[model samples]
Target: MLDSLKVTVLAEDSVPYESPLLGQHGVSFWLEATAANERRRILVDVGQNPDALLYNIGKLNIPLAQTDAVVLTHCHYDHTQGLAQILRAIGKRDVPVIAHPSLFRPNFITAPFFRHVGVMQGDEPADVHAAGGCLFPVVGPMQLMPGLTTTGEVPRVSDFEEVGIALSTIDANGRVVPDTMPDDIAIEARVKGCGTVIVTGCSHAGIVNILKHSVRPGERVAGIIGGLHLVEASEERIAKTVAAMSEFSPSLVAAGHCTGFRAQAAIYAAFGDRFATMGSGTVFSFTA
Candidate 1:
């Protein structure tokens, strides 16, 4: 059986009216799907502010008990900070927490001006004490459920994809150093009769590469959802990314987060109505 999927943004730059929810500078996606005769719910990336995450989830009236698992794409604070709150909300249930082993490494990348913003240091894994959940380390592509899988460590395929982004982690000497994004991964869902939907939380590992790695050898592309992380791209980089994306023939793109408004404009110009904006309070459903 095919799954019924709905992606709701529990936190984003904008909030829905009547919800009185405030927007935070982070990204989190709440996804639910029914597959293999069972209803499955997964929270991909827990967002930064717990209050905002909880408020939006409550405002959306999502049943916390229904959540089956929590997948942290990476150890970035914006993506994993509110995990504790989510586990608390779920109560008593011990779900699996899938992530890269590096996710628990301390002193990951520091934001451009992290000192001024007073964000927590990325040294420890987010606390999940609701029922003492387990951390499932993943490397390379791994099956999450029946039709859902994680395209682990996307390859850098284009110059524009890594333009000017110098990611780093603290070394053994505790000095900030340069590093590549080995922990980056994207979630892929094989939709029945609709092909696949490759969802990412900031395509640090190239959006083009994520789509290419999601398939076996020659599978058709369906949709590309989530952040493309093209905020500070140069015109040349943007042009190249747009040009390459066209070849994949994705049906729809629900992109946001670090994608930036300017980048989205360029994408809209190239892809037209196929471009989608993802944020808090947004919902995407897939039915079989």
Candidate 2:
């Protein structure tokens, strides 16, 4: 079991403090887990800009070289563009990079405007290998540490939750298809005395669906952090999401990045004191 979990926001769309930390249209989190005298450091999502990630880490006094593993929540540029730089910063060639095989496929958003939002073009896998990092492509749920696991491909059972029209990808036949974002995964940890804490990236798989797929039977969710991807959601959709989240009654909900102000307000109204604002340089510590 995890004795405690510390999550530090290394890069985000906003900055809560007036420090020299850099902010961008992305998200990155530094996770530290301790269990039975063993400590594990993990990086979830690298953000879009390497400068921001590096600067924030330096300002936060985080040791970049100590990361045990790097996990990508999806293939979106905002969540993965800085992977190579991060690997270089760690200065290790054998670090493990856990992600889905489908992450490299061409993906983009086309609703409001057409733009290529996939991982940076040209030889990302090769770059990772050149950086001396080994890639672990997963298709199903897998455990990374003693009490930490990835949700893998979340099953979409929520009727109100559906992949938006804005996102799509190219098929093998060069046909454009709706990108279901199967690679969108979340980190789930069983905190010894505090139940479970779920950490997400963009939550493109749907936060409700992710929760249903991640939370085990008889387990309570103590907290949830990261983007909900409700920036462009309708009022009805936001309301439904808030209602579903209430079922888990998470003690803490720190929403940021793709979670827009409108959705954040609704979540705040619903979760009340349980909701905490998140941004670059934000630090969350949970103990058993």
Candidate 3:
């Protein structure tokens, strides 16, 4: 039986990812979480370009048929754009697509003053059929696979995270609605002795919230991998984040994607070598 899980970073902006796998822009990550003698692969987000998504998958030597499930952090094209090409690979593989149900909404990417640039142009697929088909539409917290579960919409409880950033969508009725990014979710894996590894995307709800909500009040957090959304964060916010992270005492901090280089540097400065870099191709083995 499976006694451990392995994680692989398929695509991202930093680390050793191949530029030719996908266009230089956009974010996509492929994670292979294995346990027992079987392996299950997950596409955290598909890149903006279909070709890059396919190429990256091939370059990584990850078989398309082996993808067990596809989880989206949100509906943004950068996160879900690759669904089209993926659907063509396995020919309607009945894999479960996990994410907040709101991801399927129409005009989900419409934001004011930046509609053209928010979601990648020409990246939207006409339908899920064109995109890959997902069997289970997870709206809240639930066990997705063995030792793997999704942390449904994270609660926003930190004041330091409010740096006056606008993340919302404009409705057809001319309503400018605040974007809660309800579709945001994180994958939590329990590692034997090592504790829990939280794999987050964008962390739109706030990384602290994602981490806090993913585990019980007293459970130890072992490691964190993925976007911290600290690219434009103020120093105060960063300080608060660092302070909160210090409590987790994670063995490693593999930060990337929307995590600004400056923020990554700051994290490294504070945590020293405990903070490591993660990108496409980076892998971590966990023992149970």
Cα misplacement distance, residue 264 of candidate 2 (Å)? 0.5
Off by over 4 Å in 3: 15-23, 36-38, 106-112, 116-126, 130-132, 162-165, 171-174
All models: lDDT? Answer: 0.72, 0.89, 0.70
**Candidate 2 Cα lDDT to native:** 0.89
Task: TM-score each candidate.
Answer: 0.88, 0.97, 0.86
Highest lDDT: which candidate? 2
Clashing pairs in 1: 106-123
lDDT of 1 at 125: 43
In the range 247-277, model 2's lDDT, one tens digit per residue, is 9889899998988899999999998998988
Residue pairs in collision within model 2:
93-132
Arranged by lDDT with the best first, the candidates are 2, 1, 3
Ranking by TM-score: 2, 1, 3
**Superposition error at 217 for model 2 (Å):** 2.8
Supply the TM-score for candidate 1: 0.88
lDDT of 3 at 32: 60
lDDT of 1 at 205: 79
What TM-score should be assigned to candidate 3?
A: 0.86
284, model 2: CA deviation in Å? 0.8
Give the residue spans of candidate 2 off by over 4 A: 111-113
